[model samples]
Target: MKNFLNKVLQQHSLIYKLILYVLTVVLIVFLFPKGGKFKYDYFKGKPWLYENYYAPFNFAIQKSQETIDAEILEIEKNSTLYFKFDEALVQDVRSNFDERIRQENYTSEIVEEILPIGQKIISSIYDFGFIDSQSESKLTSETLEITLRKGNLAFNIPPDKFITSTELLQFISSSLANSAPVELRSSMLNILSEVIRANIHFDEEFTEKAKEERIKNLSYTTGFVAESELVILKGDIVEGKKLEALNSIRRELESQVWSESNYNWVVFGYSVLVALALLMLLLFLRKYRNDIYENSTKTTLIFLNIALMVFLVTVVVKIDVKYVYAVPLCILPIILKAFFDARLGLFAHVLTVLLLGFIVPNSFEFIFLQIIAGIVTILTVSELYRRVNLFISIGQITMIYMIAYIAFTIIQEGNIEELNWFYFRLFAFNGVLAFLVPFLIFLYEKVFGLVSDVSLLELSNTNSTLLRMLAEKAPGTFQHSMQVANLAEAAANEIGANAMLVRTGALYHDIGKMNNPMYFTENQSTNVNPHSDLSNVDSAGIIINHVIEGIELAKKNRLPDRIIDFIRTHHGTSLVYYFYMQEKNENPEQVAIEKFRYPGPNPFSKETAILMMCDAAEAASKSLKEPTAQAIDNLIEKIISKQMEDGQFMNADITFKDIVVVKKVLKKKVKNIYHVRIDYPE
Candidate 1:
C-alpha cells in the first residue's frame, strides 16, 4: 500500500497535484447551486420593455386633438363675417335698377353722370346704417338705398353698390373671428382689424358681383376656414406583446450571463490549478537552488533567464511548431554549462528532456535528440585540458547533434533528402552554441571565481598561481608533491576514482612544510638535520606538527575542502617507521611506537586513502638502487601489504582487491618513472 501510494504520487507532479486540489475547491464552489431554480424572474425581460410597452402614443394624439379643439372653440368665440363687391356687381345692380325703374330709356343713362350722386348716397347709407337700421335708406335721385342687418343678415344693399376686394376680405376675416376658438378668434380678430384699418372688406355686394361674371373671372370669393380636430391613435397591442417577449428573452440571457454554472466552475478551477502549479514549481526550484549554481545570485539569474527562454519557446510552440521545435530542452544544458558544473549540465539535460516530453506535442523524438546533444556537449567540455582545442569539442558536440537527428529521422522513416537539411541545421545551431560556451566560461571566470568542475584542472597546472607559490615557498614540498601526484593519479585511475582530484590534492598535500622548510628531510640541503640535537619526543612533535600546520595553511590559503581533507587524513595513524626504528634500537623496551607515529584519524575518505597510500609508496620507492619492473612491483606490494597489516587502511573504503589493483598500477607507473638501465660504454 505504501509503495502504491508513493508510485501514484510520483506519477503526477507534486506541483500539479497541489494545483489540482485548489482547482477542485474552486470547481466545487462555482458549481454549487445557490438556489433550486435555474432561472430568476427578475431578469427575464428585455431592458427596454417598459419604455416600448408603456409609452403613451394615445396620450400624445389626444393632447394634440385637445389643442386643436381648444383653438377651434376660441376661434368660434371671437370670429366675424364680412361681404364686398366690385365692377361686376355694379353691372348687375344697374340691370336690376333698370328693371325696377321699368323704363327702357333709363338703361342708357351713363353711370358717369350719376357717379358723384351714387357716391354721396352710398356714404350717407353707410352713416345711417351704423346709427340704426330705420335710418339706412338715405339715397339721392340716381343712387339706390341698401339696408344693413345686424346679427342675422350681414348687409342688405342695392345692386349698384361698389366695394374693393380688400374691403370684402376684411369683412370675411371678421366673420371667421366670431366663430373660431378664443385663441384662433383673437388671431382672426387681429387680422380683421388690420384689414379693416387697411380699408379691405368682403360682403354680399362682392359675392353678387363675382357671381355675374364667369367663376374663373370672379374678382372676390368668400373664404371658408376650419381647424381639423386631432384624434389619438391607439397603441399597438401586438407591439406590446412583442416587447414583453423580448424582455423575457433578455432576462433569460442576463440570468445565463451571471448565474453560477458548472462550466464557469470548471474555468475557475482550472485557473486556480494553474496558479498553484506555478507556485509549487517555484518552491521546488528554491529548495534545490544550491544545486543549480555555485553562486546564488548567478544561479537565480541563470534560472530566470532559462525560464524566460522556455516560456517564450512554449508560447511559440503554441503558435506554430515550425519555429521552436524542441520546446526549450536545449536551454537547460546551456544554463548548466554557463552557471554550474558539467555533471549538473548532464542532469539538467535529462530533466529538461523529460519536461519537454510533457510540454511539447510529439516530443519523444526531440527529447531523444536533446539528450544525445546535451550529453555530448557537456562531456566534451567537462575537462579544461590545454591540449584539447575548444573548436574540436564544439565540432564533436555538433557531430553528436547531427548524428542524433539523423538517427531520429531514420527511426521515423523520414526521407534522406529531408533528413540531410534538418541534420545540417541542427549541426550549425549546436556547433555555434557549443563553441561559444568556453568563451562565455572564460568571461565568467574572469568576473567570478573558478567553477568547481574546472578548479581541479587549474590546480593541476604547474604555472597556476597557487601551485607556483607552493613551489617557490617550499621546493622540497613541491618535489614531494610531484612524486605523490604521480602515484595518486595512477592509483586513482586503477581504482576507478577521480584521478584529477587525487593528483591535485596530492600536489598541495605538504603545503605546511613551507612554515619550517629546513626542519623537513626533503629541504635539508646540509646533512646537519634540525631534529638531530632534539630528543626523540621533541623531534616527533615537530614532525607531527606538520599535519596540523598543513591544515591551518590550507585553510589560510583557501584551498578546496577536498585538498584539506587529503592533508588531514594522508598519514592515517601510520608510524614514522624510520624514526621509530632508530629510537627502538637505542631503547627497545622504553620507546613507544605511538611516540613516533604521525597524528591521524586514519584515511576516512577515498581521496585521503589514495593520498595516504600514494605518499607512503612514493617515500619508500626512493630506497631502490636499480629500479626494475619486478623490483617496483615488489616495492608496491610490500608497501600496500604493510599498510593493510598495520590497519592503516582501516577507515578507508578500499577493499583488498582494490588495494591489489592500486599496487599494480603504482608498480607500472613507478617502474616507468625509474626504468631498468641499459649499460653503455661510458
Candidate 2:
C-alpha cells in the first residue's frame, strides 16, 4: 500500500494533466449542439463535390423563406374582410319606433299616419344594413365589397348596399320631404333618429381566424422527391431545383428526432472527434514544447483561451449563425503569441478553428477564412506593449478575412453583385473587438500569475524604484550592469533569443552589490582594499553573499521570477577563483572550495544562459591592460571556454552553435567600447 501511494505521489503531475484534459474535452463536447450532421456538403451555384446522390427517403422540396414570405403578403392584401349582420337587432329597432309613437298619446289619425311613416323609415334603413360608424372609417374607397355573415350563411355585399349613420340621416330627410308636412316631418325625424341603430358590425375575430386559416394551409413545399430517385449527379452545379432538393434533404436529416440509442451514439461521435483534436494539442505540447508542458499553469492558460473562444462562437451560432464571423477568433493566436511563441499560438488557433467548423454552416469557408486570419495574426502581431502594433495587426487580419470571404462569395455566387456586404461589417466589428486583447492579457497575467511582454516592458524601465536604488547606492555596479545589458541584448538578437528579456535580466543581475557597495571590485573607487584587511575566507564569504543578497532584494521588490532567474544563475556554481586561490596558497592543506562558491541551480534557458555569457565577458574586460582586437577576442574565448568547462550551461536549452555566435558578437562589442580597430584576417 505504501509503495502504491509512493507511485501515485510520484506521478501526481501527470495525473493532474490527465484530469484537466478530460474535463476540457467534456466541457467542449457539452457546449456543442446535440444533433445529427448532414454528411454531404453542397453550396448553391457550386459544383456538387460528392458522389451521385439519390433520395434516401421521401421528403417534400421546401421553398425558400423569401418565397414563403411573398405568398403570405399576397394572402393578407386581397383576402375577404368579414362583417356580422344582426337580424334580431333590426326587428328591435322597428318595435322601439312603434312604442315611442304610442307613448306620445297622439290623436288617432296623427298617430296612424306618423307610426306607418316611422315604420317605413326603419324598415328601409335596415334593408341596406346600417354599418357601424367606427368600422366604416377604417375602409378606403378602394374597398369595393365586404362579406356579411348571417349565422352560418355569408353574403357578398357592395359598399352601396350598407348605410352609414350619415347616409341614414340623409335617407330620413329625403323620405319626409316628399311624404309629410313641416311640423309632422320634424317630429317624425326626432322619433326615427333615436330608433335607428347600426345592425352590421366588423367581425374582427372571425376575419383574423379566416386569414390565419388561409396562412396555415399555405404549401411550404413546391414538389416532392421519392425514395431511390436521382437527386443530383456528381460535379453538377447545384442551382435552382437541385439546390432546393439538397437543402430540403439537409433540413430533414438535421431535424430528425433521434431514438434514445441513436442520441447516445450521436453524442459519442461528437466526443470522439473533440477528444482527438484536443489530444493532438496535448501531444504537440509534450513533444515540442516540454517546458510549457511541464508547467501546469501555462498549459491551463492555453487551454482556457481556446475554450473561451469556442464558447463565444457557439453562443453566437445559437443566437444567429449569420453573425458567426463577428466572433474574432484570431484573438486566440494574437494573445497566445503575446504570452508564448508564434508557433504554439498558431497551432492552438488552427485546432480551435477546426473544432468550430463542426458547429458553423459552410464548414470549408469558415475553417479556411479563420485559419488564414490566425496565420496573419501570428505573422503581424508583435511588440504587444505597443498599442499601434496591435491595431495594425488586427487591421491586417480583418482585411484578410474580408478578401477571403469575397473570394468565396464570388466563387459560390458566380458574380460580385450577389456578394453579402453584411459579412464585411461583421469583419469590421471583429477588428473592433480585437482591441480587447491587451486588457485580456492584463487580466490573464493577474489571474494566472503569468507575465507577458507588456509587463516586461514596464519592468525594463530604468527609472523603476529598485533600479533607481541600485544606481544611487552602487553607481559603479549600475554602470557595469548597463554594459552587461548592452552586451546581452546584442548577443540575444544575434542568436535569435529573447533580447528584451535578456537585457532586462542583465540590468538587475548585480543588484545584490547595492547592500555592500564597497565589497565588490566595481564599486571601489580608491586603492583602499577593504578586503585586504580581512582573512581570505571572510572576503570570499562576502563575495558569495552578494548573490544571496540579490535574490532577497529582488523578491522584496516583487520582481517577476523570470527576472530573478538571472540573479540566481549569473554566477552559476562557479567558484570565486581569485579568493579561493589566495586562501589555498596561504593554507596549503586546509583550503575548502565551497566557502567561495555562489549558490546556484545554474542557467536553464537561452535568455539566462546569454546573460551568464555577457555578464562574465563584460566584467572581465575591465581588467585588461590594453584593449585591442586580438586581446578582446582571446579574453572572450577564454572566459566562455572556462565557464563551459565547468558545466555552467549544461542545463540550459542552448546549442554550441548559438554559443559561438554569442562569442563573436561579444568580441566585436567589447572592441568597439575601447575604439579598437579590427585587423583583417590573413
Candidate 3:
C-alpha cells in the first residue's frame, strides 16, 4: 500500500499521470446530475412522431406547473388573514388615557366633570380599533378570534365582526348626555379618540399556514390516466392538454421506485459507460499519439475539454432540455484540434457526445447530429491559422447540423414539413459562438504554454519586432534564415513533420547574430575579419557565444519554448571547423574541442533535426565557387550523412528513410537558389 501511494504521489511518472487521468474522469462523471429523460422528444405544437406512452405503473397524475402556480396565487389573494384580538392593547390604551385626563392643567369645570364619563365610554367598548366612529359598533364574538400573551392563551373565538369606527364614535357621544354641556362633551370625545387604535393585527404565520391548507385541499389533477391507456398517439399534434399529459407521463415514469437489486446495476451501468468512453481516449493516445499522452498538460487539456462539453450539456438538459441544442458541441473539437491533432479532437468530441447520449432526450438523434458536426469541424479546421478558415468551417458545421436535423426529422415523420426550424436557428447560433474559438485558443496558449500554427504564423512574420530587428541589424543572417526556412519547410513537408513549426523555427534560429552581426561571415560584407586579430580559441568562444546570445534574446522576448528550441539546437554540437583546425595546428595536445562546439542539447525532434541539416547545408552551399547539380547534391548529402554518423539525430525519432527525403528536398531547394540549368542548352 505504501508503494502504491508512492507511485501515485510521484507526479513525474507515467503511472501517476494515468492514475490522475482516471480519477479526474471519474470525478467529472460522478458530479453529473442524475435526471430523468423521456424516450421521445416531443415539442409543443408538433406531432408525436414516436410510439404511444402508457401508464408504466400506478403513479398519480400531477398538475402542470402553470396550474399549480395559478392555484397558489389565488389561495394567497382570497385567504383571509387572522388577527388575534389582543386584550392587552386595549388595557394599555385605557391606562394611558386615564393617567392623561387626570393631569388637570386647564382645571375647567366641564373637563373635570366629563373625565369619568369619557373613561366609562372608552371602557364600554371592548375593541379599541374603532372608538372614534359615529356609527354603532356591530361585532359578534363567534367569528373573531382573541389571543392573549399569558401562557397557553391561544384560542379561536366564536364567529364575530369587528366594530366600525363610526359606530364606536356614536356610542361615545350617546353615553355623554346632550345637556351636560357641549364643550365638555367635545373634550370627552377627543379623549376617547386618543385611546383609539387597532388591537387587531394581521398574523402572517397563521395566514400562510391556512393558505397552504387551502392549496393542499384544492384538486391537483382534473382527471386520471388508466393503466395501458395511450396518453399521446402517433401522428397526433402534441400541444395544449396533450403536451401536458405527455409531460405528466414523463414525471410519473421518473418517479418510479427502484429496488435494491437493480439499483447497483444502475450505478454500474453509468460507471461502465463513462469509463469505457474515457478509456478509449486514453488507449488511443497511448497507442497512436504517445507524445501527447506522455505530457500531462496536453492530456489534461483534452480531457478537460471533453468534460466541460459534457457538463454544459448535462446542466442545460437539467435546466430545460430544449436548450440543449444551443450548446456549441463543435467547439470542443475545434478547441482540441487547435491544441492537438484532428484524430484526438474528433475522438474526444465523439466520446463526450456518446456519454451525453445517456442523458439527452432522443439520444440517438442527438448523437448523430453532434457526431456529424464534430466531423465537419475536424475537416474544416485542418488549417486553422487563417480567420477565413474559421468562418468557413463554422459555416460548414452549422450547415451539416441543419441538414442532418432535417433529414432525421423526415425519416422519423416521413415528411419534410415536420422539421423544427428552431433547431436550425440554434445551430446557427452555435456557429456564431464558434467564432470565439480563436480567442479561447489564445487563452489556452497563455495558460498552458502551447504554441499552435496560428501563433507560429504570427511569429514567422518578418515584420515582427524581433525578426525585423534581425533583418535590419543582420541582413545577411536574416537572408540565410529565409533560405533555411524554405529548405526546412520543404523537408518537413516531405517527411510528414510539422512544416509550419520548422519554418517558424528557421526564421528565428540565427537571431543571435544580431548582437555581433559583423563577427559572423554572412553579415561581414567586407574583407575585414574581426577574427583575424583574435586568437583561435578566443574566436571560437565568440562563435559559440552566438547560440548563448540567441537563447537569451529568445527568453527576453518571451518566445515559446518550442521556437527557442530551434535557436538552441540548429548547429547540433558541431565544432567551428576553421577555428578548430587552426587551434589544433597551434597546440594539438592542448586543444579543447568542447570550447569550439556550439553548446547544444542537440536536435531533440524531427523538425529541429531537419533545421540543423538545412541550416548547415544552406550556409555551406553559399561558399561554392563552381556551383553544379552534382556539387549541391554532394554538399547536401555529405552534411546530413555526417550528422547522422555523429548520432546528432538520435533523439529526433527520425528514420534513415526520412533523412533521405530531407536530403533530396534540400538538394532540390539549393539547386533552385543557384538557378542550376541543364548543360544541354550549351
Alpha-carbon lDDT, every model:
0.56, 0.89, 0.79
lDDT of 2 by residue, 234-254 (tens): 999999999999888887876
- Descending-lDDT candidate ranking: 2, 3, 1
TM-score of candidate 2 relative to the true fold = 0.77
Best by lDDT: 2
Q: What are the RMSD figures for all models against the true structure?
A: 31.3, 7.4, 11.3
Could you estimate the TM-score for every candidate? Answer: 0.50, 0.77, 0.65
Better of 1 and 2 by lDDT: 2
TM-score of 1: 0.50
Q: Name the better of 1 and 3 by lDDT.
A: 3
* Candidate 3 lDDT for residue 404: 90
Clashes (N, CA, C under 3 Å) per candidate: 50, 0, 14
Off by over 4 Å in 2: 65-220, 676-682
